[model samples]
Target: MNSSDSLKLVVKQQNLEDISHYIYAIVYPIVFLLGIVGNLLSSLLFSVTKLNRTSCGVYFLLLAVFDTIALIGGLHHCLNIGYRVAIPNATYCRARVFLVYVSMDMTSWMIVAISVDRYLKVKYPITARIYATQKLAMIVSSIIMIIFIVKNVHLATVFIGDFSSNAADNCDANPLYPKYVAFFHNVWPWIDLTTYALFPFLIVTICNAFIIHDQYKRRVKLRKRNLDRSLITLLLVSSISLILCNLPITILAGVYTHISTSTNTND
Candidate 1:
C-alpha cells in the first residue's frame, strides 16, 4: 500500500485495540459491585452480631473490610480505565492509586495475621492468649496500613499516560522522576508480590502444617477419631479457600507486569 494508506491502516488498528480495551473495562464494575455488597454483608455479620465475636470472626470481619476497600479502590479504577474517563489530573489519580495499594496491603497483612493467630492458638495456646487479642491484632493491622501508605506514596505521583512509542495504555509512574519511575512501576509490583503474596503463602503454609501436626498428636493421644476428623476437615477447607482466593490475584499481577514490559519492548 502507499504511505498514506499504510498510516491509515495503523491508525485503524489502534482504534480497534482501544475499542477492545473499552469493552473489557465493563466487566470490572460488575465485579466491583458484587464484591462491595458481599464484603459489606460479611463485615456487618461479623462485626454487629454478638455471637460472632471470636478471634476468627474478628479476622474475617477485617478481611471483609479490606475486601470492600479493594472493591471500591482497585476494581473501580479498572472501571475508570475501561470507560476512559478524563483522569488527566494528578491529584485524583494519586488518590485512587493510594487507596488501591493500601487496600491490597491491608488484605495481605490481615491474612498473615489470621495465619499467625491460628498458629498460636493451635500450637501455643498459652502465648496466643497474650498475643492474639483483638486489640493487638488491630494495632498490628494499623501499623501495616501506615507502612504501606508511606511506601506507596510514590505510586500516587505516577500518572497513567504515554511513556514510550509502543504503549497503548497510560501506565502509572511519576513523570518528573524518570530515574525511579520505571523501577517503581515495573519492579515494585514484584516486591509487592513477594511481601503481599509469597510471604503470606509461606506463613499460611507453616501455620497449617503445624496445626495438622498438633491435631494428629491430639487424635493419637485421645483417640477421638470422629471429633478430630471433623475439626481437621474444617481447618483444611478454610485454609484452601484462603489460598485459592489469594493466589490468582498475585499470579495475575506478576503476569501483567511481564506482559506490559514485553509490550513496551516490542513497541
Candidate 2:
C-alpha cells in the first residue's frame, strides 16, 4: 500500500482502539459496582443465613469469593486500557495474570460442582443425601482450587512485562521458554476452551437436562410443585446466562486460534 493509505489505516486502527478504551473506561466501573454489590449480598445471604447449611450454598459462597477476586483482577485491565496505567514489571504481570486465571478457573468449575450437586439431589435424593454434604462440598471446592492453582502456576514464571509503552497489552510469555511459548500459542487456547467453556458447558447442560426431565416427570406424576423450585430456577438462569455470555467470546477465541495456527503452519 502507498504511504497515504498506510497512514490512513494506522489512524483508523488508532481511532478504533481509542473508542474501545473509552468504552472500557465507562463499562468496567459499572460492571465492577454491580458485581461487587450482587456478590456481597450473595455472600451475606449464603454465609449468615440458613442457606449456608446446604452443599449448594457452600459452592455459592466459594463462587462469590472467587468471582469477586476475578472482578478485582479485571481492574488491572481497566487501569491499563482506560487510564494508560501500564503494568510496572514482570512480577506484577505474573501475579496479576496468575490470580486472574486461578480465580476464573475456580468460578467456572464451581458452577460445574453446583450443577452436579443439583443433579444428584434431583435424580437420587437418597444417594445425594449421603454424598452431597457440606463437608463434601468443602472438599470438592478445595480440590478444584488446588487443581487450578497448580495448573496455572506457570503463569507466575511465564509472563514478562513489556515496558515499551503505556499500552494495555503489556504481558508476554518469556521467550526463554520456547516450549511454553509454543504451548501458550498453539495449545493453551484449546486447553482454555475445554476448561473455561466446553467441558463445563457440556457437564452443566447434561446435568441440567437430566434434572429438568426428572422434575417434569415428577410434576406430571404427582401434580405438585417442585420442592426445590426456587433453587432450581436460580441454577437454570445462572447456567444459561453463563453459557450465553461466554459463547460469543469462546467462539471468537476458537476462530482466532484456528486462524493463528494456520498462519503459523503456512509460515
Candidate 3:
C-alpha cells in the first residue's frame, strides 16, 4: 500500500471509531433511562393488577427484572466505550461481561416461557389452568436462570480487563487461554445467535401461529371467545416485534461470523 493510501485508510478508520463513540454516547443514556422507567411501570402494573396471580404475570414480573439487569450491564459497557471510563479491575470486568450474557440469555428464554404459557392458555385453556400455575412459572423461571448462569459462566473466566490505552477496548478475551479465546470468537457467536435470537424466534413464531389459528377458528365458529383477546393481541404484537427486531441482527451476525471464520482460515 502507498503512503497516501495508508494515510487515508487510517483517517477512515479513525472517523468510523469516532462515529461509533458518538452514537453510543448519544444513545445509551437515553435507552438506559427509558428502559428503567418502562420496567418500573411494568412491575407496578403487575403488582397492582390481578395479572400477578397468573403464570403469565409471573413471567412478566421476572422479565422486567431480567431486562433491568441487562440494561445495567449494557450501560456499564457504554460507559467504557462512549465515555472513556475504564473497567477498574479484572474481577469487575469478568462479572460485568458474565452478567450481561447471562441476563440476555435469561431474557430470551423468559420470553420463550411466556410464549409457551400463552400457547397453553390459548390451545388448552382447561389443561393450562390445571397445570400452569404461578408456582410452576416461578420454578420454570428459576430453572431457566440457573441454566443460563451455568451456560455462561465461562464468560466470566474468559474475559479480562483490557489494560490498553484505548478506553474503547474495555474487556477482551484472556490471551493466556487460547482455546477459550478461540471458542469465544469463533464458536460462541453462533451459539449466542441461536440461543439469543433464532431459537426464541422459532418458539415464539410457532406459538403465535397456533394462537392466531385458534383465534380464527373461534371467529369462524361464532363461539363466544373464552380466551382474552387483548392478551392474545398483545402476544401477537410482541412476537412480531421480536421477530422483526431480531431477524436483521441475527442474519448479520451469522454472515459476519462466517466471513470472519473464512478470513481467519485464509490467514
Candidate 4:
C-alpha cells in the first residue's frame, strides 16, 4: 500500500481499538460501582452471620475483597483512557500492572478453590468433612496468595514507563530485562492469557463438571439441590464471563501475532 493507504489502514486499526476502549470507558465504571456494592454487602453478610464460621464462607469473604480490588483496577483503566493520565515512572508503571494482575489472579484462582471445595463436599462428603475445614481453607488461601505473589514478583521490575514529554502509548515491559528481547516480547501476552484466563477456566470447568456428576448420582432432593443455588449461579456467571470475555481476545491476539511474525519472516 502507498503512504495514503497506509495512513488509512492505521486510522482504521486505531478506530477498532478505540471503539472497544470507548465502550469500556463508559461501561466499566458502572460495572465497578455495581461490583463494589454487591461485594460489600456480601462481605458484611458473610462476616457477621453464621456463614463466617464455615470454610466456604471464608472463601466467599476473600473473594469479595479481591473482587473489589480488581474493580479498582478497572476504574484506573477508565481514568487512563478518558483523561490521558500518563505513567510517570517505572515504579508507577510496574505497580499498576502488578496491582491489576495480582488481585485478578487471586480472584480467579480463589474461585477455583471455591469450586473444588463444593465439588469435594458433594462428591466425597466424608473426606470433605475431614479435610475441608475452615482452617484448611484459610491455609490453602494463604498458600495460594503467597505462591501467586512470588510467581509474579518479576512483574514489578518488568514494566517501563514513558519518559517522553508527549507520550501517547501506555506502559510496556522493559526490553532490556531479557537477553532475548524478541522472545520476551513474543511471549509476554501468554502470561495473562494462561494465568488469568485459561487456567482458571479449566479449573472451574473441571471441578463443576465433577460436582454436577456427583449430584446426579446421588438421590438429591429438589430442596437440597436448590440450597446452593445462589452460590452456584454466581460461580457460573463469573466463570462463564471470564472465559468468554478473555478467550476471544486471547485467540485474536495469538492469531495476530502469528500473522505478524510470518510477514516479518517473509520480508
lDDT: which candidate is best?
2
Q: What lDDT tens digits, residue by residue, belong to model 1 across residues 1-267?
A: 899999998787566545644544876667778888888888889888972556667777878887787777654336433543333445655676677777877787787778778878878888877767777766777787788888777666644433443332234554666767677667786887777667777777778778888887887789865446666676677677766766677776554444344434444
In model 2, which regions exceed 4 Å deviation?
A: 1-12, 158-168, 223-236, 248-267
Instruction: Summarize candidate 4's per-residue lDDT along 153-242 as a digit string, tens digits.
Output: 766765353334233234444455455344445765687689878998998888876765566545365435443566557657866986
lDDT of 1: 0.67
lDDT of 4 at 23: 54
Q: Which residue pairs clash in candidate 3?
A: none
- Measured on C-alpha atoms, candidate 4 has an lDDT of 0.70
Instruction: lDDT for model 2, please.
Output: 0.76
Instruction: Point out where model 3 deviates above 4 Å.
Output: 1-12, 158-168, 223-236, 244-267
Question: What's each prediction's TM-score?
Answer: 0.74, 0.82, 0.82, 0.79
Please state the error at residue 36 of candidate 3 in Å.
Answer: 0.4
lDDT of 2 by residue, 100-177 (tens): 888888888888999899899879999999988889899999898899988888778744433233212456556667
Per-residue lDDT over 59-153 for candidate 3, one digit per residue giving the tens place of the 0 to 100 score: 89888988899899877546654665655466777787688778878877888999899889879999999999988999999898888888888
- Each model's C-alpha lDDT? 0.67, 0.76, 0.74, 0.70
For candidate 1, the clash count comes to 2
Off by over 4 Å in 4: 3-8, 158-170, 178-184, 219-239, 245-267
> Residue 95's C-alpha lDDT in candidate 3?
87
